[model samples]
Target: MHGPHVVVVMGVAGTGKTTVGPLVAEALGVPYAEGDAFHPPRNIAKMTAGHPLDDEDRWPWLDAIGRWAHERAGYGGVVSCSALKRAYRDRLRAAAPGVVFLHLTGDRELIGERMSQRKGHFMPETLLDSQFATLQPLAEDERGVAVDVSGSPHEIAERAVAALRAA
Candidate 1:
C-alpha cells in the first residue's frame, strides 16, 4: 500500500504544469500548490526581467516547495514545478521521499507556440529556449512518468492521473 501520493507536475515553462496540476489534485482530493508561488520576489523579478535562474537562485525556491510537500506528506497533495534538472528533483525527494513527478513534455516548437499564446504571465516565450536547455529528463531510475502535452488540458490531467496510478 502507498503511504500518501505527493504529485509534482513538472516540466519546462510551456508544458502546462500549472494548468493540469489543479485538476490532478481535484481528482485526487488533495491540496494543490503552484510552485511558481514558492518563488521569492527576487526570483520572480529575475525571471520577469528575462534572466534564467542559476542553481543558487533556485535552491531556496525548491526548498520552499519541498517544505510544502513535506508538510502535506501524510495527506498527499499536488504541486506544479519545472523540476527541470535531475539535481532539482533530487532536492525535492530529499524533502519527501515518496513524492512522485508527472513530467509533461513536448517538442520545442509546440511549447513555444503555446507560450506565445499565453497572456499576462511573468515568464516570457524568450525563456522557453533556456528552459528546454535546462531540462534534464527524468532518468530510468527516477520515480516519475512523462506525459506528452499534445492533448487538451483535461485530457492531459486525465493522462497524468492514469500515469500516477500506473506508476
Candidate 2:
C-alpha cells in the first residue's frame, strides 16, 4: 500500500471534494486542507459573478495551491481542490511529485443539481458548465485514483482510501 505518502482530493465542485476529503483525511489520520479557502478574494468575486477564471487568473492561485499540497507530504495532510486543468496538475506535480490525486467523478446533471441546492459558496450553479468545460480528466499515469460518485459520501471516501492504500 502506498501511503501517498501525501494526497489531494480533486474534482469539480459538488463532486464531493469537501465531504469526501475530511472523511479520507480522518481515515488516514492526517490533517485536511480545503483549497477553496485559499482562493484570492478577486477570484472569488469573479466566480460569484458567474464568470470563469482563465489561466491568467488561475496560475498564481494554482501555484499557491500546489506549493501547499507539496508541503502536506512533509507535514502530513490531505487537500481538497478542483484542480481542473492538466497544466495546473503538472505544476502541482512539480511541487509534490509523489502527491496522489483522488479524483471524484460524478454526472454533470447530478453535480449541477447539488450545486443548485448549495448555499453560501462563492461558486454558483451557473458555473458548473464552465467547470466541466475546463476540466481535463486525468490519465492513468497521473499517479492517482478515480472514485465514481454514484454512491454515498462514505462510499466515495472508502473507495478513495482503498485506492490510496493500493496506489
Could you tally the backbone clashes for each prediction?
0, 0
lDDT tens digits, residues 111-162, model 2? 9888888878888888888888889988867978888988888988898889
- Pairs that clash in candidate 1: none
Q: Would you estimate the TM-scores of all the predictions? A: 0.97, 0.94
Model 1 Cα RMSD, 1 decimal:
1.1
What is candidate 2's local distance difference test score? Answer: 0.84
In candidate 2 the C-alpha lDDT for residue 95 amounts to 83
Q: Candidate 2: worst 10 consecutive residues by lDDT?
A: 1-10
What TM value does model 1 have?
Answer: 0.97
Q: Return the TM-score for candidate 2, rounded to 2 decimals.
A: 0.94
